[model samples]
Target chain A: MATFDSENAAHLHRELHSHLPSDPALRVKTLESLAIERGLVAPQTVDAWVEAYSEHIGPKRGAQVVARAWLDADFHARLLEDAAEAIKDLGFQGSATGHLKAVANTDRQHNMVVCTLCSCYPFSILGMSPSWYKSAEYRARAVREPRQVLSEFGVALADDVAVRVWDSTAELRYLVVPQRPAGTQGWSEEALAAIVTRNSMIGTQRDLPLEAS
Target chain B: MDAIHDLGGMQGFGPIPIATGDKDFAALADWEKRMWGLARSGVAQGVTIDWFRHGLERMVPSDYLSFAYFNKWCANYLMLMLDHGSITLEDVKRGHLLAKEAEAAPKSIDDVLASNAQANISFEGACDTPPAFAAGDAVRTLRIPPPGAHTRLPRYARGVEGRILAHHGAHAVPERGAEGKKDYQALYTVAFSAADLWGPEADPRDDVTLDLWEAYLVPA
Candidate 1:
């Protein structure tokens, strides 16, 4: 449960592993201060961009899309046909969404996403890719041993269901539309959106539970 | 050919560590934020993502693994700015802009965000040749490593057999993209059985699909 920011600092300090000549923090601070002090960028502009990513964009935006798709058949159709345009309906458009392709999970097929080479996620929509998603372990095991990896994430798939691991190695970002849970046929979009976790949307965990266990 | 960044199937790295909530960024020191902002600013100044990535790839393996992610971003941004003539080494070393000619016009917040959106262009580059593989066609990735300093193809995916899932049209070749070339190559999602990729230890019902370019594939 360690944040990459905190954990990475520890990693940087691990002299046994790191060969850094000085604290990386000092180097970055020097560069960042220089960039702002010299007017290469304004402090306010950087703050705004960070605020946009941390607050404006996130799994909730994705949950809204998922919930609407579950409620309206046509919206679901649109989502499958052209995800980039469909997502734009909710006013979520940006760099990370370059040609998004949504793959729905069904009774017979399950979808999971990983970027083995690098963390090429739709950050503009899904917020920051989780630190784990960027970890060397998740990147390596997600593709080579997905079922095992999923099990570690607490997703136990049925043996008969085929699991599709999408290695997002290009500009195409994937959104896994997990199967709608049973007994939620008439739920409101707001109600459904409450249950969709970021993990479920990424296919590492199951869709929102029907009534919170 | 195989870099530390190519971590797939490598052992010893343990389970994923999970961190919840918005506090993730709170862990960022002020410098990391500046590093990120500077990189985005570079992008706004017309530096291509592929080109920036190529700059990061140019890092020596030790530095690649040792430097924190944002530190890598900082180092690469400095190198690219110097290489692209956006800034001189004196500007970086002195921690201030020394030349009137070196100053890049500061972009507004809206302009920065808009430029970020525009950078996410869809597949628009032209392809002079027809696609070499079709959906449902069996194809095997060539065992060759990427010819350049950077590539999207992971090491584990090479020499594997898989079925073409879809033809995503001719797109700018990633290898060429890294080299600042606008060349096009056929791209497809090829699906390999987990068992095929990892032997019987893998689940029989699982398939791993990767988006690979035409230059990386051949008849199975």
Candidate 2:
């Protein structure tokens, strides 16, 4: 956990005071304090909301979806056919998930998702987006040079395997159903989920083997 | 519309930095978390997610990058509140709203979460206009400047030729929605070949698929 630095705070105050009195960061803090003071906002309520996303709702939810898809053929078909309904079957539903299209990475073709306009993501399932996904560099290069971008993320695909980048410009959210690893045939859904990670589903990284998990 | 935010197939940007393992919201700074909470609360107060996004897009690209992710959200949240008259400059300057300056704000987590949950729902409904293109139809993006305001059309995709991959039905055109208009347009997933969009620098085997409104495309 990193602490806020006063040097940066001083710099911000100096730069933005002309537009507003306090530093932007301090201004937000002050606003929060005022809200609390006026009973307009409860700190506990905010903490609970923050905790729900930070602690409970995350890749593990998506991992469960992936693992269940791996273990049950019917579930896999359901997820690909209508992800929203199928995801709801598992009791997971929320924002930015109204329409989910699950693209599987096969032996010959790979899929990666990027929002070129803005960072539109499957937040309800995958949780909050990573900073790099929202970065200008990723938005620019992912469509222009996906092979290069994936390689930078350490995902070096063979030349023969074609790469398809899904730019989430509209509301459609994509989940890259990464190809399941071998030798996990008889593994339970819970066991398979242990190896699934957030980046793997984003197609920037691969799922670890059972041993790695 | 030739703003910095529409970054696709552009040059000069470096590599994407990868974070190891999966940690949800663990990397966010305290102020970022506060901004997230505040922005979530804004949804309950009638600010649409698209509206908040438009405010973010309104920012200068350089300044947008200067702030962290939630910092950008915080800045935009403040702007929207001011623009909507929910907060005044005096309130902001004083670091607290005066007795009568404060209006409606979300009081509970449920209100915020419920409104935040609405952000996930796609903007789809009955669209009266007929679709101009279908799957497998060749089309070219229109060479039009953004109305100098918020639009979903990225500059990089402008005037580029592609094939419609799928019909995503009709959506409330973001350009109109940003302007507080309720116009709708047919949308489709258009796929452009790498060579077609990026020329020789791109690998020939790759394809970039984007969801575009009908107004942004013309029959090829």
TM-score of chain A of each: 0.86, 0.85
DockQ of each: 0.31, 0.34
Model 1 spans > 4 angstroms off: A1-21, A37-39, A210-213, B19-30, B43-46, B88-90, B99-119
Could you tell me the lDDT of residue B129 within candidate 2? 74
Model 2 chain A worst lDDT window (10 residues): A1-10
For residues B152-220, write the lDDT of model 2, one tens digit per residue.
Answer: 777777788999998978887777665556666788989999888877877888898888888888899
Q: Once model 2 is optimally superposed onto the true structure by TM-score, how far is the C-alpha of residue B92 displaced, in angstroms?
A: 1.3
Instruction: Quote model 1's TM-score.
Output: 0.87
State residue B157's C-alpha deviation in candidate 2, in Å.
1.2
* Candidate 2 segments exceeding 4 Å error: A1-17, A20-24, A34-40, B19-23, B100-119, B145-148
Give Cα-based local distance difference scores for all models: 0.71, 0.73
DockQ value for model 2: 0.34
